[model samples]
Target: MTQAPGGGTAGRWAKRDASVVWHGFTQMSSYLDDAPVVVERAEGHELIDVDGNRYLDAISSLWVNTVGHRVPELDEALRRQLDLVAHSTMLGNTNRVVVEFAEALASVVPVDRPHVLFASDGAAAVEQALRIAFQLWANRGVEGRTSYLAFGGAYHGDTVGALSVGAGGFGTEVFDPLRFPVLRAPGFDDPSCLDVAAAMVAEHAHELAAVVVEPLVQGAAGMQMAGPEGFCELAEVCRRHEVLLICDEVATGFGRTGTLFASEQCGLRPDLLCLGKGITGGYLPLSAAVAAGHVFDAFLGPDPSPRTLHHGHSYGGNALAAAVALRHLQLLEERRVLANVGVRSAQLARLLSAGVAPLPGVGDIRVKGLMVGIDLDPPGPAMRWGRRVCAAAVRRGVLLRPLGDVVVLMPPLTVTAGEIERIVAVLGQAIAEVTAS
Candidate 1:
């Protein structure tokens, strides 16, 4: 065991972390005992802990990482930006890099004349989209368009507005008092969720400002997915009703779903889109709320008047973030990442079907591009199979995380065939060990 600075054994780092830093969605009293990985640094697709242990980051660092960590091109992009500037207010003024990046993004996002409002994270992006949808109706003098329609099993973000639209799981029930109500539709797990949502939209179009959905995959909802055709039908309903459609692609965007945006696969051109997670290749805090030309035009009357949105974030369009984001976009094309996602997604599905599906402890498997969830079956309502299975995988040098009983696998886009095999082998071993014991 290595000796760390403050304590004797480096494992004390978790204890030190528990004493100070409060982690989200973690029980602080059991933080140190839970044996959280004290990550010192990362290389390629592996995270190196303080004790010099390297674990394959099978979850893509909670699905934020896209290409890989410590990427040379991204590092160079950040360094080049640092030579000029770091951050400036995007409030009344704009930065050069912001314009350049936004132009690149606008050219690609699946929206008519997309205009981006940058934010620091996904929650803010979703919140911005919600606010824009609400204000669009108010600005256009449309009455009774105050409520929103969001599907069940949808997890947008943690902010109040985002939570209001979200289906509310993952220990978020305590904050229900703060979450405003929205028209609820069936979750993606339901075969006819999209059709049901469309019906609800048509029935409640009078009071609906927008219908918010997570296009192909409801990521936080245990990677639940629906067919692309359902999304197309729901979008058509939103179009016919003249209710703005908002796609919260904070998890499914930036090639996570076999395309630049999941909306592209679903043939959707939403009025507003929320983007995050992989925007800067997991390098920085960057997200955006994209508005179509029509929605953008709604707020175009009188600059210093009620039409103008009275909201701004201090570090909305930080130059460093924009610089890295621009490079990331270019690299996505240059490296042919999306094509690789297709090939690997097929491989992943095949491998899971052959190796993991028939196990006595396995229940179900879902895959959409590189995003995956393997549900575990425990006899007699056993608890924490997910947590134990993930911990066993970590001990075997592959990092995995779970949502309830669904173990997620989200490797970086650049992951190789051998790495995928290694991940699958380790997960199978982990599951075997846990179920046997």
Candidate 2:
């Protein structure tokens, strides 16, 4: 292949990026020095960069591509929809695809009676959920029930309201001044943690609007795995306190936790469920805040009043996204993706525990479905170990993104058994190399 203008393959693209594009969550000034990989195209499980390096895409391209890259069904669905309509305001007008998608979602979304309210992404969905829950309380003329309870290591999203309920102990220190105070309990997975959570909710129930949580697992918080016991206890406490229970299943949804939804594993249903990320098979940005029928009733009022839900995005229910999402669901059902996740997840857990757990400096390897977090011990050496190990794995072909010493694996659900073994083997080698060095 002929190289671009400046020098290497990505020279032209790099120059263009340097002059115009400002990437998110990155320091652009030093970006040119490192020169980010320019992906040319993606096959099923691999990404081909401008330099022709093939990466396994083990992180699922930031944990969104649940199935795989260049999925023909999803791509064709988007293309078909694009040929018809690409953009339209979803404020008053509705799309046939969006309506159908909502119908499909309502059938299996865990909530007893679901009414879908679309949004652009996970954070927006979560914000809408929190707003709806609070608004429902307000509409009922409930006095002082306004606060939200959350777990200590919870990470919902980056938006203002999401930042509010998200615990401040993490890297959110800069946003502390801007965040609203939220009641937090111990990490939900800890033993006897339910009692602590219940006590906190009971104390604040009179002033609590909702208790929002990432059901069974908290993703961004180092891919931490919390079992259903804590979630069930929290749900029971919320039920007793009359506080709304909002479950953020953006990461754990769509069979990531070996179930259709993590709530199913725990047998607990929340008043509101926020979903996104893998909702559209990672093809498009689509999210929804699903509320029960009673919660929806709060928004229905006789007059133009505060009971109505005033929050909605212009791309709230895009026809193309919905079509793609609906197709993604059909693909899931047609392929039995949930059962695949369960099988693959068990295989991965066993491989990690048997092959990688004995490595030096390795603390714990927690696996829930495809979401695996291998936590390393100590901050100094282990942090460097994680970075080096991930870099080595990248060299070996798998793309693993580590979170401050925790190497997380969130591969596509369609990954084959051979790919699973390779992934585990590469990770094992990476761990051994890092620790030995």
Candidate 3:
């Protein structure tokens, strides 16, 4: 192999990584051919590979990084909390920083009198929400309210409970046996999907305990979106049917969709809300399943009774993560990050429209705030256009990943005008190069 610019080599680093690492959703057989970037350090929104190449983090570090990498305030918050305490179990006991962080979160989340249950990952948050919704009925003496209603393109999480509600794909079909069936509604791509879902809720209200949705955008479904009016109608139906609503905002939370949460735009106050990803500003692993006061009260009973949720995580409320999350929430308001999202969203939309949408290989282009997916249209099934195009972009110093044929671009919320332009330009170049051949 040829020598790299930096003292270390990417090939050498990848070999070391592949020998010891088992990456999720990745095939280890050809991992070396995929040309993964071995990042040694990060500065702001760019990641410097072991070979000394700097690539703009257009995917927001797998859609978790909110403000940017190495944010000074977030770093300080983590360091400050580290000096105080690192880990304290949240089982039957609480941490000061955790309580404070939850209080601040409850104030802003679109849940009424929210009570939070901390977890370690987005999947865990969604799984807990599923368990809570299932048990909320049993605690209230409601019989046969055991099943859930989910949309066609929904992607909740990979856990058994979460996968049960999610529309299966992404090579998860083998888990079909583990996934308990749910009442299915059409995907958001259909104009009348919400109406159909509302009707299904009304019809199946007897056995249905809850309805889980990815409000505004079905992120893992290639960014399929629906109007806010549709969500408003669905919320009304859920209320009328007395079915609990669970909004999985793991992907759309923390100002990623031009608001603090996507539920705000959709006029929803869910009984259960799942939050993660950017909760700690991409600094630490922390997720939360927030239950509305009404739902939370259902689980209250004797100290050692069945009403209590039997679920708890060991590192659920790490003080260090809580401290960073508290500061990250504050930073969102202090820096006016939502205001920046609105500006950058409009700029990104306009540039993508002018530059990429008109390209021959482009199909549907979806945009919701900084989240975007550009579909690639290939005549035959042999071409992996999405993969090849993203590889081309990565080679051009812009980091992007694809959801199958949809090239996803989730730039950090603090992306600048120049960076947005660069992303669009590189995307266009990559698309042209892949489609022409």
Evaluate all candidate structures by whole-model CA lDDT and list the values in order: 0.91, 0.84, 0.92
* Candidate 2 residue runs with Cα over 4 Å from true position: 1-19, 29-35, 378-383
Off by over 4 Å in 1: 1-9
User: Each model's TM-score?
Assistant: 0.97, 0.94, 0.98
lDDT of 2 by residue, 36-63 (tens): 5567899999887776767889999888
TM-score of candidate 1 relative to the true fold: 0.97
Q: Score residue 422 of candidate 1 by CA lDDT.
A: 91
User: Model 1: per-residue lDDT, tens digit, 136-218?
Assistant: 99999999999999999999999999999999988889999999999999998899898889999999999999999999999
- Write the residue-wise lDDT of candidate 3 on 1-437 in tens digits: 11232235888889888899999999999988888888989999999898778899999998899989999999999899989999999999999999999999989999999999999899899999989998999999999999999999999889898898999999999999999999999998899999999999999999999999998999999999888888888899899989999999999999989999999999999999999999988889999999999999999999889999999999998899999999999999999999999999999999999999999989999999988988899989958899999988988889999999999999999999999999999999999999888
State each model's C-alpha RMSD to the native.
2.1, 2.8, 1.8
- After best superposition, candidate 1 residue 4: deviation in angstroms? 16
lDDT for predicted candidate 1 compared with the true structure: 0.91
The full ranking of all candidates by lDDT, starting with the best, is 3, 1, 2
Lowest summed lDDT across 10 adjacent residues in model 2 is found at 1-10
